[model samples]
Target chain A: MNLALRDIRHHLGRFLLTAVGLGLLLGVVLSMIGIYRGLVADALGLVRAPAAEVWVVETGTRGPFAEGSRIPGDTRESIARLAGVTETGSMTFQSLEATHRDRKLRLQVVGYEPGRLGGPPAIAEGRGLARSRFEIVADVKTGLVVGERIPLGGDVFTVVGTTRGAVSSGGDPVVWMALRDSQVLQFRLSPAPARREAARGPVAAGAPDTINAVVARVAPGASVEAVVEAAKRWKHLAAMTQDDQETILTRSVVEKARQQIGLFTTVLLTVSTVIIALIIYTMTMDKIREIATLKLIGAPDGRIVGLIVQQALALGLIGFSVGASLIASAKDFFPRRVVMLPEDAASLGLVVIVVCLVASGLGVRLALRVDPATALGG
Target chain B: MTGDNPRPLVECRGLAKHYGEGETRVDALRTVDLDLWPGEVVGLLGPSGSGKTTLLNLIGCIVEPSAGTLRLDGETVWEGKWLRPDLRRLRLEKVGFIFQFHNLLPFLDVSENVALVLDMAGAATTDAFARAHELLDYLEVGHRKAAKPSSLSGGEAQRVAIARALANRPRIILADEPTAALDGERAGIVMDLLRKVAVEQSATVVVVTHDEKILGRFDRLFHLRDGRIEDMASRPGDLTG
Candidate 1:
């Protein structure tokens, strides 16, 4: 008979209750990992959507995703003229909050030329931008459907399409509009500012034709590295290949968040280990007398150690299962996308098993020290 | 009548136990020479701190002897140092212990408590349970075999503890105050049961107690005071050495 199981069965209610409390703690750890993964996925979504081979931004700037970058809208034409460049599109990004249906909606507005290479990767509903001036393609997460009119910059735009998983680095859903329309909204001055500008000096002739970055696709037989080097030849423009852009975004934009989450996870696991050790130690102390009795009866030390280890393993595994299940069923309810992969759960399960083994050490040591002669005393 | 056997089941010569050193030294058991034969029920009567329990611990091979040669079931188990490399295995194979309060594991049912000893002895699971049931039946507590120790009455628990001690059919059974918690009638009944077990199994039974009410049950009694055997008494009709 497994003495550990027999003892747990005798105290089934209390054991399960303890496991549930432990499960909740483990659940927080799992969520931290999922949130970290979601942050990376969200950070990379917009960068990967356009599928550009090369990016050209203002000189000395990392890229639009890492920091502010601006270049003449005509930079698209200059990049398209490079030897290996096949297509080029100008793109702009701005984050804004707007009231729609009396509910506050936060969105990342993306500006890309409609017929170029930088539109939404795929349209999940309705159609792409047919009329550029006031048509927008919204991400499904934005809670907008086709034909819904939303006001931005004192102008209303009709939702023409919807996309999935299209979000900004900060986890806000994205919406796409025509390049010219975004330029107008981004550069247009309000009446009061325009009047003040006129009183000081003559206002600029027309809206500023500036875009955040220019993206290029290389021809199949052409070298993307060669195109990037050629683009860098322009003194006012900085160039990067798609891989370089992704690396900068992940390394510079989200590195701190990753480190913070990793630290929190380590602390939580340490706390888990300590808690389990104390609990097992207490449980062992409670049965010191019984252990002495068993020893007096000539029980092998292996049996006593096995009892403690098996119970620790059971508690850890049951707690892990409960935490995993709770997270799996509730991930969608979180404000940020909580991404859970199969390997994540498997890895955490392995860690929990090791933790339990390590935690049972204190109990095992205490049990082995008990003097069997004590049982023969009063 | 059984004294004619060629050898005693337990033999001790110049056995002694001491604690600490120098100014703080204490002797738990003074040098003693003793022999207990099979099929005999003996008692060690003493006051608190008189070392009755210490002597029992030494005889059970749990405590290290300061200066002594000890043998159980014809095998020298300890002599200043352990003669056998594994004293636990020796005890498992040759000796049994019963405690004052029964000490039945609360988590295990009465039957499992008895069967645990057989299990530790490497008996097959089915065979161990069968032997546990047989012992419980022999002890007349078979009806309470399925109940947990917590639910059983004190007398019933003690009977289960006895069944556990006898599970391996050990040659030497050392019980410390086996009936210390029992009433007059129950104490007498338990003593009779121990005597019956000793005679039928041909085992040596040694009990340590201060209860004089059951004094008549032991075939022979040793009075231990200040760690020495001060006197020995053999009841009428019992063989004396």
Candidate 2:
């Protein structure tokens, strides 16, 4: 039998307990990695589904997620007139909370034309939006089913269909409605404010035609960069390629969460390395007599080092395996999506193995320093 | 003791060891000289603090002599240049060591403990275990070959240790108080086994001990007092001739 397995079998309880403890800690680290991935995925899911090669927003703004964009609704018409522009759709997004089933349900209300790029790519249940007003397509997470009616902004809208994985950058489920109806809900004032506005004289009610941004899809053999450059010439418009939108979403919208997760992952890795080193050192200290005897009996230094290193590697492998399994199962309980990609687990496993090798250094040093003379004692 | 020239298996000339420096300098060994023949048992007898174990350690090559030349089978194995890796390999291939405690790996069974020597010697697993079984049977612990060190009685454990030491079939065995923890009967039995091993294996055996009960069992005795040999006398007469 190999020395590592033999040693573990000799102290089965202690070895298993240590491995379980380390595995739990590694599970948290793995979850953090998945959570970060989930944040990026959720942030980009809405931005990418439209299949628009470029987005047009107000100048001096990163995107709708980073800063409010108040581009004129007519910007879509101006952008469509450009060469190689296959389709252009004006869309608006706003976070709204509605009481449904006596529960506060938060959602991102998306305003888009019925037949356009910004509509739901696929519906999970029922039919997508078919009417022009008072009809909605909701994400499955919105907890609303087909044919359900919910009071939203001076109107009770019916949920006509349900879409999966369609969430805003902030993880709010999305609801799709006709552009004109969304404009009324977003820009129209309450009845009391409207009466006060009438007394102040005839004035526009927040300009119902204003939109958040316009998305454009390029024709075949057309360059997204060329379209972006053309759209940028409109002094009041800020145009970005899909890559630019993803960067803004990742580096700004979810930037703080990413940094926090990054810091946590680093701290967890450091703690794991230190804990492994300490465990290995303690084990080596306990076996000083056996090691000295082995040395005195003429076992080579390499063999001694191999014994210590093999045990460390075994510990890391077992711990990481437990951690990965935990993440694979526990992800279902997470409210936000937990995306544990196969490559992520594999990469973390490799890192843990490297950490195991480095952590074995302390134990190897102790084993080597064990005077063989100690075995020939007085 | 020196005899007709097959050459001594172990020879030490002016072997000395000192620890610390300057004002704290303490000599652990001082100007010791000795020769051991093949197929002989040498009892190293000394009072507490007489440096019997120190001398044992020097001969075992666990401690380098401060000043001396140590020759094993007429080849220089120790000088000042122990930093060279060849010395360690020489010790591994040419010497076996036993401690007062059995010191067998607690995780390993008796047979595997014995087979470890062959493993270190790069023997194949089948051959190593076969030789280990043969040695265990020869040592009379073959019945307990599958038992862990923790389960064995003191005598059984020590016998297994002897089997382990003999696994590589080295030319010399250095044992330190191999029977210190055993009672008179077991002690005598262990001493007899050492004597038997020397005769049957044609290997030089040096045992360090203060057990007066087994004194008569040695072919020769070397008494130590204050890091120096006081006497080298043959037991009975002209033994191992």
Predicted candidate 1 versus true structure: per-residue lDDT over B1-241, tens digit per residue: 3655768898989998989999999988898788998999999987887778888999998888999899887888887688888777888888888888899999999999999999999999999999999989987899999999999887888889988999999989999888877899888888887888788878899998877778878888888888898778888123222
**A190-296, model 2: which lDDT tens digit per residue?**
35675455446433443347788899999999999999999999899989999999998998889999999999999999999999999999989989988988888
DockQ of 1: 0.74
lDDT of every model, 2 decimals: 0.89, 0.86
Candidate No. with top DockQ: 1
Those runs of model 1 whose alpha carbons end farther than 4 Å from true positions after fitting are A189-206, B1-5, B183-189, B236-241
| Candidate 1 docking quality: incorrect, acceptable, medium or high | medium
User: What DockQ score does model 2 reach against the true complex?
Assistant: 0.62
Model 1 lDDT per residue over A1-378, tens place: 889999999899988988888888899899999999999899888998899999999999998898888788889999988897889999998888888888999999899999997899999999999886889999999999998999988789999999998998899999999988787667653356754553464323345677899999999999999999999999999999999999998898989999999999999999999998998998899989999998889888999999999999999999998899999999999999899989998999999999999999999999999998877655
Q: What residue runs in model 2 are displaced by over 4 Å at the alpha carbon?
A: A188-207, B1-5, B236-241
| Cα lDDT, model 2, residue A55 | 95
- Residue pairs clashing in model 2 are none
lDDT of 2 by residue, B100-193 (tens): 8888999888999999889888899999999999988977889999999999998889889988888898888988888877889988888888
Candidate 1 chain A: 10-residue stretch with minimal lDDT: A197-206
